[model samples]
Target: MLHLRAVCPAERTEAALDVLRRHAGATHLVLLRGAAVEPPGDLVEADVAREATDEILAALCELGIDRDGGVTLEVIDTSLSDHADRAEEAAPGDGSDAIVWEELISRTGEESKPSWTFQAFLTIACLLAAVGIATDSPVTIVGAMVVGPEFGPLAAIAVGLVARRWDLVKRAAVALGIGFPVAMAVTAVFALAGAFTGLFDRAAVFGDQHQVDFIYDLSAYSLIVAMLAGAAGVLSLTSAKSAALVGVFISVTTVPAAGYAALASVLGEWDRAGKSLLQLLINLIGIVAAAALVLLIRRRGATDGVTTRPLSSG
Candidate 1:
């Protein structure tokens, strides 16, 4: 279930009410007239089935509540009202399977933005991965993966493709395009510094690193793993079960490959660096392809039982 709070202008209140009343998935509706101080409008709140979110939000958007006022949707973690249960039953699809398009787009769009925090996490993840590669430690590699933030923009790219949001696509692309190179370059510098201090050995990185050897090994299995992880990552975001994302994070070798590429380049092992770069590219491409596919399937399912007329008209 989801909780919707909307501030609607007086003129559009009736229209918003009518739309909410017409939807069987909406319940516990409350209207506080002239309660919005900033917008100087009425505050409307309701509990809605997750599956009906897209449609109800579309209707609100059609009424210009989103443009003239504001609408906020929040997950109802524990709704004790029977009306909420009835609303869920009245809705068409399972809540977990439903794709809230507005919510998904808003979330991915925000996450995809190039921020200092995003760059910091990516750089730190790469640095950790550099340490992992130098030590040939799977544990350190997994830790680096967990700390990596690359998946946000990657997932956003897939969402943008499906939703036809070119702005989002561009933002995600810029984030990734700039982020990875910057992170790799920083890691390369760190590697050079480590080498100067005798803390990193080029021969160790190029030979007998079985535990972390897979970072440079691009194979069919690598593609398959990336595809699965991508699918799972999208599902985790859309389904609001974000705990699953941690598993997805560690399942792919994106950060580790970048780390290896940077380190190999620093060590002047051009061949190994190229192979690691190839591995990174394969994982990235595989993830985006698979995530797009998953989102398309979910989008189709969301549209099956719901009409997009409101969004279309708007």
Candidate 2:
């Protein structure tokens, strides 16, 4: 369920009330006239089923409430009232499966930005992966994968393509294009310094490190794993079940591959670097393809009025 609050202009209050009254998914409606100070409007509040949020928000936007006033949505973690349960039952679809496009888009937009924090995380993850490759440590590689922030922009790219938001697509592309190469370059320098100081063994990077070799080893399984992880990552984002995202992070080899490529380049292993780059490309393509497909299918389902169940029972 979601708690929706809208500051409606005096002239549009009736229209907003009608929308809530006519929707079966809305309950616990409250209206306070002349309650908004900033916008100098009436305050309207309602508890709405999650599945119906898209339609409600659209109607409010159509009424120009977003421009003239404000609309805020907050998840209702626990609703102890029977009215809330009845509202959910009255709604057309499952709350968990609901694709609240407004929420999703807003979230991805902020996350995909090329912020300093994003760069720091990406660079640190790459550095960790470089060390992991040099020492042939699977644990360090997994840690780097979990810390990598590359998935945000990647997911944003998929969402943008499905939503046909070229602006978002361009922003995400710039973030990834600049982020990956910068991270790789920084890690390369770090690896070179470590090797010179005798702290990192350049030979171990090319040795039979069975545990970490998969970072540069491209195969059918790499594609399969990336595809699955991409789908899971999208599902986690849409459903607000973020714990599943950690699993997605550890399952793909994107960060590891980038780290290995940097290490290989610093060690003058051009062939190994090429292979690692290929692995990186393979994972990126597979993940983007899978995530875009998932978003497109969900958007189509919503358009066709197909109700979807949540991935897990709350």
Candidate 3:
């Protein structure tokens, strides 16, 4: 279930209330007259099933409640009311299968920006992966993968393309195009410093580091794993099975490959660096393609009543 709260203008209150009252999955509706001080209107609240959230949001949007007034939705972890259960059951589809577009947009929108925090995490993950590569430590590599924050922008790109949100696509593209290069450059500088301090192992870069060779050895397997991971990642986001996202994190080698490329370049292993970059590109391409396909399928299969509009619609 989801908790929905909307402030509606005095003139539009009835329309918004009707939207909630007519929906089987929108229950426990409350309307407080002149309750909104800021917008100076009525306050409307309801418990909406996950399956019906998209429809309700779309309806409210069409009435311009989200613009003149305001609308907010939050997850309801538990609902003791039998009314809640009935609401969920009455909904056309299972909650887990629902795609709440507003939620997804809010979640990925900020991630599309190449914030300092995103750059920091990516650089840190790459540096950690570089250490793991030098020591041939699978455990450290896994940790680095979990720490990497590259998936957000990748997901944003997928969602943007499917939802026809070109601004999102542009922002995500800038994040990836700028963030990766910046991370790799920082990682390379750090690797150079480590080599000067005799902390980085040149032998690992030049010799047979078979344990970490998979990071650079791009193959059909890399593409397959990346696609699977990408699908699972988007599924996790849509279904609210966020824990599954961790598995997706460790399954792709984008960060590790970047780290490997950075260290190899600093070590003058140009061939190894080239191969690592190829591996990164392969994983990125596969992930974006798979994720876009999944979102496209979900959008196509959406219920007729459920429609998605950009947060800022034209």
Q: RMSD in angstroms, candidate 2?
A: 4.8
Q: Which structure is stronger by lDDT: 1 or 2? A: 1
Comparison by TM-score, 2 against 3, better one: 3
Candidate 1, superposed: residue stretches over 4 Å from native: 304-314
How does each model score on TM-score?
0.95, 0.94, 0.96
Q: By descending lDDT, how would the candidates be arranged?
A: 3, 1, 2
Full-model lDDT for every candidate: 0.89, 0.87, 0.89
**Deviation in Å, model 3, residue 61 alpha carbon:** 0.6
Sort the predicted structures by TM-score, highest score first.
3, 1, 2
| Model 1 weakest lDDT span, ten residues long | 305-314
RMSD (CA, Å), each prediction: 3.1, 4.8, 2.0
Q: List runs of model 3 lying over 4 Å from the truth.
A: 304-314
Clashing pairs in 1: none
Please estimate how well model 2 matches the true structure, expressed as its whole-model Cα lDDT. 0.87
Candidate 2 ranges beyond 4 A from true positions: 303-314
